[model samples]
Target: MTQIAINRPCPPRRRFGLSLLWDALSLHRQRRTLARLDTRALEDIGITREQAEAEAARPLWDAPEFWQK
Candidate 1:
């Protein structure tokens, strides 16, 4: 097998603190907005109230870091 070197630049890393903060705030706002939506509106989006709540409860930093294998 031969190894090749590419000159492509790596993508910028996301700031964890900022990412976490933004995601948390977004989740909070989304939850509030979603709760106000009627069942018909939620059905149009193909998501249930339970699903939205669960998603909002997930930690923003749960994904693996892009730089890690």
Candidate 2:
């Protein structure tokens, strides 16, 4: 009996562009939810309606730096 070794091809790595798209979509959804929150709900989270509005007004791809990680 003889032992044999086989080499397999590695799968392709995911492109960074896909992650960016996903992040943008997530940001859009979060902003929409934030915009829909009532003043009372916003207050509970210590955020003013104007602040929420400002955040929601940002572009989908304008996510915070931390999100890139």
Candidate 3:
């Protein structure tokens, strides 16, 4: 006996939406990590405490436009 398999393509709009969702989630995680970093760590990254705070304060969906692409 033989089995057959079928596959369906995902719509472009849905794919784009999923991409955006992923970007938002990634941004959220990164920001959280940034918020937890110590002053030394922030300094190592060359970002001041105020800059880190500002980045952490931004909404999850507030990523740069190029990130969506």
Candidate 4:
């Protein structure tokens, strides 16, 4: 007798709206602008360059699906 593996459904691919892409890009731009600010300026906004970098590094698909509304 021959043994065969059972077929399985493929995992869904990640999808994103244009708005999500824009939001992530905007976040990146905001991070860059914030980084250019002096330390004191960043402190006034309650954010640091490290924090901004973290935000900018987030995936575009990470944006909320607010556009679905």
- Cα lDDT tens digits for candidate 1, 1-69: 999898998987655787667766775677667777877898899999888667656564444354243
Question: Across residues 1-69, which tens digit of lDDT does each residue of candidate 4 receive?
Answer: 999886997775554688557777786677567657777887898988788667656664555465344
lDDT of each: 0.69, 0.86, 0.84, 0.68
- Per-model clash counts, in order, read 0, 0, 0, 0
Off by over 4 Å in 3: 1-15
TM-score of 3: 0.69
Error of 4 at 17 (Å): 2.5
TM-score of each: 0.50, 0.69, 0.69, 0.43
Candidate 4 at 50: error in angstroms? Answer: 5.1
Q: Write the per-residue lDDT of candidate 3 for residues 1-69, one digit (tens) a residue.
A: 999776887554544677667878888999999999999999999999999999999987688776654
- For model 1, the stretches where C-alpha displacement exceeds 4 angstroms are 1-6, 17-19, 56-69
Cα deviation in Å at residue 16, candidate 2?
Answer: 0.9
The order by descending lDDT is 2, 3, 1, 4
Q: Per-residue alpha-carbon lDDT of model 2 for 1-68, expressed as tens digits?
A: 99977798777665478776887888899999999999899999999999999999998767898764
Report the Cα lDDT for residue 22, model 3: 84
lDDT of 4 at 15: 49
